[model samples]
Target: MQQSKGRPRTAGAGQESSAERLDGHGREPTEDAGHLRYDDPWYDALASGWGESAGAGEPVPAVVAAARREDESRGAAADVYLEVQRSAAFQEVRRRYRRFVVPACVAFFAWYVGYVVAATTAPELMARPVAGAVNVAMAAGLGQFATTFLLTWAYARHARLRRDRAALELRWDTQELTRGVDGGAS
Candidate 1:
């Protein structure tokens, strides 16, 4: 069998190497084979199975039980959240968002692409002076920025006017439902 000079390869060997058997520390094993080589007392005790079996079949403490109950309540609250997510109100909000965003994105992208194509293909037209030093290209480029801000304001206004109240009501309703399920303490 081929062998390396450092530690012997323990691939097919029955025993583990000292490195493999290290108990959370880099130290080699001591004279007592049962004791772990860890420097921390807690780690040594843990490795030796200390205090492990004491609470094996015991009932959970009140604090732990309360925490578990809270976790279960939170899990149930998550189900309430999911129900709200699947509700018509939530779906309507999403629909409104998509309705605005999709068309706006498509129009803006098309306008941008048209601007780029015009700039590249019709350089002479783009170079035509609109005012003093500002040309058609400059005006169109500035228009892109103006359109972006206008679209942003319009979207925000639409959301505020049309969807925000409904969506907010839905959120409040969901929160109330979850709080009720959690015994009115959210």
Candidate 2:
């Protein structure tokens, strides 16, 4: 319903009529009538950005779609970042290494100490080397080092894989969110 200056303001029949109404000629209303409610000018004024145009039912430009997609990719990246932060796989890998690595090392040292004591206390066993110059203590120590190295390597690999998976998930989610926004805006 368009209101105009000097027009009599009356309520519909059966509704109480107003004794006085503010006709559309308020100083500001006269100055901006073209941009009044229900007009394109008003909508344009409210729409200040590219997203606003999309909100106004305007066909978004291709560049806008691409930009939205990029934004979505970033959001996806953020999601992956969060998932990695929450992932049990990543936590478990770290936990396992902490729980077992030190204990294994301690056990190795204990075994070496025991072997050393046995060798010093019993020369018969020490004299009989398992392989030229390499007796039981040397063999056990070398084996312990090998096991430690392998465990460290395995834990590192597992942690790396978990991080990568989390990153990939975030990337995809960001892309999808952007795409959804683009479609709605367009």
Using all chains and alpha carbons, the TM-scores for the candidates as numbered come to: 0.62, 0.30
Name the lDDT of candidate 2: 0.52
The positional error of residue 22 in candidate 2, measured at the CA in angstroms, is 71
Runs of candidate 2 exceeding 4 Å displacement? 1-94, 161-186
Total clashing pairs in model 1: 0
Off by over 4 Å in 1: 1-67
Residue 52 local lDDT, model 1: 29
Question: Candidate 1, TM-score vs. the true structure?
Answer: 0.62
Q: Model 1: clashing residue pairs?
A: none
